[model samples]
Target: MSTTTIRVRAPSEVDDARTGPATGRLRRRIADNLTAYGFLCAALVCFALFSWYPIIRGILLSFQQVNFVTAPEWVGWQNFATLFADPLFGVAWRNTLLFTGLALVVGFAIPFAVAIVLNELRHAKAYFRMVVYLPVMLPPVVVAILWKWFYDPGPGLFNSMLRAVGLPDLAWLDSTDTSMLSLVLVATWAAMGSATLIYLAALATIPGELYEAAELDGANLWQRLRHVTIPQTRFVLLVMLLMQIVATMQVFTEPYVMTGGGPEDSTVTVLLLLYRYAFTYNDFGTASAMSLLLFVFLGGFSALYLKLTKSGG
Candidate 1:
């Protein structure tokens, strides 16, 4: 008796309400896709003009010889062969590898350790972080100049202090043996600030409750750090490590400005050698060949980084 008065709405009415808007929305989405694809096509065109063209040109240049006024002549792999046979090239390679290895050990480790220490500080955290990160804001040229003055052979701040304190005034950047080490120290000092800031950010993201529980369970500071802090920050640390390795591999300005490839080509990095070949020697083909080789090394590192990141995830 109660259900006898029921009324039904037409299916068309419901369909009109939902389907009209949905169809309109679908049309808008198709229009949006068209606009997006149009922009992507424009970007591709720009990239071809600016980026791809130059890379293609460089590749071509690597196989040819040209004077300033003449058209380039195809010389095949002669330039690459000559570059590999160059006596200085071997020295440059060895020094570059040494500097990179030293930077990884000294530069990378110091910042990570300092960041971990800073994260544990309960008071003046902001001030400490600011102090640590301030150096990264300074220009690299300024950093190199400051270190140059400090490392001056005589009456320099470093040697003068040593002399004042009745110690030997060691040749900081002048000696071939210590020149690379001095450069590494400056680079480490300049770079550690940013690395510390990154590590600090990573450390802050770790949950507070984990530390509280660890402490409650009678874990000491070292134990807590080993068990909790390091594990949590390992991913960020690996990412930073790979980035640093890539950057350090291309080191040029520090050696170029500081020592001009040093007392005995002691600090001549691979990039510096490439620059020397291009500008100083005017051997474009050889320089381009070296550039390609350097690119390959970097590409290998990048590929490794991607593989490790995927596996870690």
Candidate 2:
């Protein structure tokens, strides 16, 4: 009789254990769904308010002649047509490409190279990094002002140094020929810090075992860099290249503050042109159209980069 009672109790306990877990799992599922839905609803509201709304409004503005006071006139493709016909549009596009190329060469490559060098340095690492990054932390206005003073043709640090060295005092920012290059230098100086930090992080992630293996194989510094370091950091380099392209294409502040798109509109970038159309001329339609064009260009390159990376992977 005692044995039979014990068997009955064991069956009841097993049933309870199974039911309890099922009930707990159901409760957890409900909680998770509620949390996910809550976040989704919040994200949708924010997107509707900020991102999607402005994009739709900008697209509409691109088709309409909108001055601040009057009702916007539906102009169809007139704005785009006008943009293509405008001579400055060509200059803006050309300057944008040139600047991106220059930035890639001087700004992107130099900082990556600096990061690699710093990674190899075993001593004074913190001091060297701080010194290299100090210029980037300075206010943009301060950087622009300081560079402008140094770039001055007469009695400027640059020209004075050149003169002292018995070299020609070439007009750096004053000339249409060299204004873009001069701005590139300043931009590279100011932006190198962010790139260096990213690259240092990437370098740190590389497995030490790989380096040790390369050393055992009698690989020199150049061979190790080419075979090991580069392969490990290829993704980072690609990401940086795309980022640099995007940033360089949207360049405005330095050129605007330094040259004012001057020396005969030679330094006029797309952003500068957009600013002129929107604020300087009060032509919202054309400005929106120009902005749309720039957006499409950037989007295309970004998509291409993604596709290439995916294919490579």
On TM-score, the candidate that comes out on top is: 2
Task: Output the number of the lDDT-best candidate.
Answer: 2
**Candidate 1 lDDT over residue span 152-239, tens digit each:** 9776899888988899988888798899989999899888898998888898899999999999999998898899998999889888
How big is the positional error of residue 138 in model 1, measured in Å on the Cα after superposition? 2.1
Residue ranges of candidate 1 with Cα displaced over 4 Å: 1-23, 37-50, 308-313
Candidates' lDDT values, in order? 0.88, 0.92
Single out the weakest 10-residue window by summed lDDT for candidate 1: 1-10
Instruction: Judge candidate 1 at residue 259 and give its lDDT.
Output: 92
Regions of candidate 2 where Cα sits further than 4 Å from its true position: 1-24, 36-44
Candidate 2, after superposition: displacement of residue 71 in Å? 0.9
